[model samples]
Target: MGGLEGEGPDRLLRSMVVADSRRGQGIGTRMLAALERYACGHKVLALHLLTNSAADLFSAHGYSRLDRCAAPDSISQTAQFSTLCGSSAIYLCKTLSVGD
Candidate 1:
């Protein structure tokens, strides 16, 4: 499962999870794709995520690692960045071509 935190152009991708039993089946990839489609439909220009793990999964899907401080306030102000995820968590982003 996965979710986005805001409706604005810059949004946070959070709460992504796949049960241990569901690993290695491409479910996470499918879920990410769906979320991207949903975000694009809502006019989101970029997606930001903090992951201590799964960076490879995201990177493979076009997300690039970035400095946490580089995140826009719209995403930096979210609880995911302020409190939930730690400083050590890897920050990644994907710029989407809306309506594509």
Candidate 2:
């Protein structure tokens, strides 16, 4: 569930979650770092995510909030963007380096 989507350099982080009971134990932080490392390994230039409640968490990890309209077609067309997450969901992005 933690992987990128889209064509070429337009990657999006499809899913990242941890059980509520396991939260605050650094799992999400570690998982996100690992996810970024994996994405970087595959040459993903940027990562995007949609969230309703974890904006603070993502922000703390270096993701910046973005307007929904800023999403490119590759992200806007996804089922997660069009249907899964609610309209109030926060859109976030971060540029990545191969060494990230």
Candidate 3:
């Protein structure tokens, strides 16, 4: 799932879960790639996402961990930050160029 910024300028990617049976088949990677494509198409400047323990997966796809205290205001107010994910959840951001 994902949330788009006002008029879709930025996007917050959330919760990418492939069934355990489907793990290792590149489904999660494909989903994230699609979101990246969408964000680039919309001219988004950056994409943010919070993950509890999936840092490796995100890192592989170019996301970098952000210091929790320095998280963007928009990410701080997300439902994943406020409730769903734990306080120790890792915040990650990826800058996206308009093309490629």
Q: Best candidate per TM-score, number?
A: 1
For residues 1-100, could you state the per-residue lDDT of candidate 3 as single tens digits?
Answer: 4445433555678667778898788888888888888878888888887787688999998889988666666666767667887877888889898784
Q: Show model 1 residue runs off by greater than 4 Å.
A: none
Worst 10 residues of 1 by lDDT: 1-10
How far off is model 1, as Cα RMSD?
0.9
Q: How many residue pairs clash in each candidate?
A: 0, 0, 0
Candidate 1 displacement at residue 77 in angstroms: 1.0
Q: Which pairs clash in model 1?
A: none
Please write out the lDDT profile of model 2 over residues 1-100, one tens digit for every residue: 3667776776778778899899999998888888888888888888899988889998998899989999888888999899999999999999887777
List the candidates' TM-scores in order.
0.96, 0.92, 0.85
Please name the candidate that would achieve the greatest lDDT relative to the true structure: 1
Q: Give the winner by lDDT: 1 or 2.
A: 1
- Tens digit of per-residue lDDT, candidate 1, span 1-100: 8899886799999889999999999999989999999999999999999999899999999999999889999888888899988899999999999674
Q: What is the C-alpha local distance difference test score of candidate 3?
A: 0.76
